[model samples]
Target: MTITLVQGLLIALLAMITGLDCWLQAFFIFRPIIVCTLTGLILGDLRLGVIAGGLTELAFAGLTPAGGTQPPNTVLCGIMTVVIAATNNTSPATAIGLSLPFAMLMQYILLFYYSSFSLFMSKFDKYAAEGNAQKFKRLNFVPLIIVTLSFGIFAFLSAYAAQAPMHALVNSMPQWLTHGFELAGGILPAVGFAMLLKVMLKPRYFPYLLLGFVIASMISFSNVLPVALIGGVFAAIEYFRTREVSDLKEQIKDIDNGDDQDGI
Candidate 1:
């Protein structure tokens, strides 16, 4: 499907908004789940967007910026996954692998931005020393604007300007290579989940994890709502149980303090 100019503009607008949000860490609308859904909406393929979003979100679940380290760019991954899938008439899985280069490109762009912006630090200090609050505030927005504009430009180029070439390239790929991409895409989500488990899985939580695995494997449903509901129930139980334990500890401490006062 050909991407109309209006659609391209809308995608660019969305990219700008999410890019700013990512820089500000204000709203997490930059996440793949939100970004992909919005991209799909703009592309007039809500179902495709939703499916791609789910897969992409999982693949990125364990990835986050830490200190100076940046993971693969989530916003580009989300947008291009949907855009490629829609434009090239390909599966979301295949599109995901195809979108990796774009995501990596954005990652490098952001890293360059970060390094380039550091050169302004001395100027920032100078403005602060001179008590120029206005200048300081304005200077802060320079990087933000540059980042936002870059996102819009790149998204427009990839989604619209280069659509024909990308479509041709996708169509020219061998069946085996396309299948390889699909297999890789399918495996990435599990790898992401394993990464998360490595950090978060505790002995006490193992039973719940095992239970979830068993339920998911043994049962078949039209959708995942039932599994989500069950997980919610387990989460609630854990929350209340932890609260009760905390309350008991507080009560015991209070009683001990009272007994010590009486003895004194």
Candidate 2:
């Protein structure tokens, strides 16, 4: 579980890239699924990374930031989960619970950054008023640099400098405590999915949800690909049906307008 300096640097570089993407809300490679997989690749354990990524992704699926509110940092959750699991030879589930504190630390750091960066708003406004686009653009990079550097430093520390302590801590945990974490980790995805459904589920989509549930329960497969494929087909059908209904409505509206014009 010795993380060499080169590996640590590579991970830090990955963190910086993903951190920038997260800030920009650009390509969402910052998601746990992608982050974890890449981290696993760097650590020479792609399978572990894929497994952990899938679990971690589900756990984080509903924890997206809303407006000014920040959820636990997804990037740290993903990286630390794989790192801890691989380093300690622990289960991914256990690593997930252990990684929570790191995630929260990043969450708080981001909140602090958000507040501190607000102080620059006046400067931005001043630049805008004076029509100094060059200064404004240069100033914009200040926050981005700070955010990415923080990510790199913290990621390097967590994955390399702190690896020994993290490994020791996982080893010292009581069996019951470890089991508890595993249980919680398994349940978290369901809870996250429920939270998502609470926000997104509508009457029109209820049937599809029910259908998916039934199909999933009735078919015991090695993987979810078959179920996903079936769901995709249904989704396509729904899309086309909805489009047809919309077209029909538009046509009726046009016909009514024409009749009214003729009568006039």
Which candidate comes out best when scored by TM-score? 2
- TM-score result, candidate 2: 0.85
1-264 in candidate 1: lDDT tens per residue? 899999999999999999889888898999999999999999899999999999898788777774235878889999999999999888998899999899989999999998889899999999999999999999988998999999999989988898899988999999999999988888877756666677779999898888888888889986667788998999999899999999999889889788756644
* lDDT, model 2: 0.89
Q: List the lowest-lDDT window of 10 residues for candidate 2.
A: 61-70
Report the poorest 10 consecutive residues by lDDT, candidate 1: 61-70
Estimate the TM-score of every prediction.
0.81, 0.85
Clashes of 1: 0
Model 2 lDDT per residue over 1-264, tens place:
778899999999999999888778799999999999999999999999999999899888777775335878889999999999998888999889889899999989999998899999999999999999999999999999999999999999999899888878889999999999988888877766676687779998898888888988998997778888998999899899999999999889889788656644
User: What are the C-alpha RMSDs, in order, of all predicted structures?
Assistant: 3.3, 2.9
- Misplaced by over 4 Å in model 1 are 4-6, 44-47, 62-69, 222-224, 247-264
Query: What is the lDDT of every predicted structure here?
Result: 0.89, 0.89
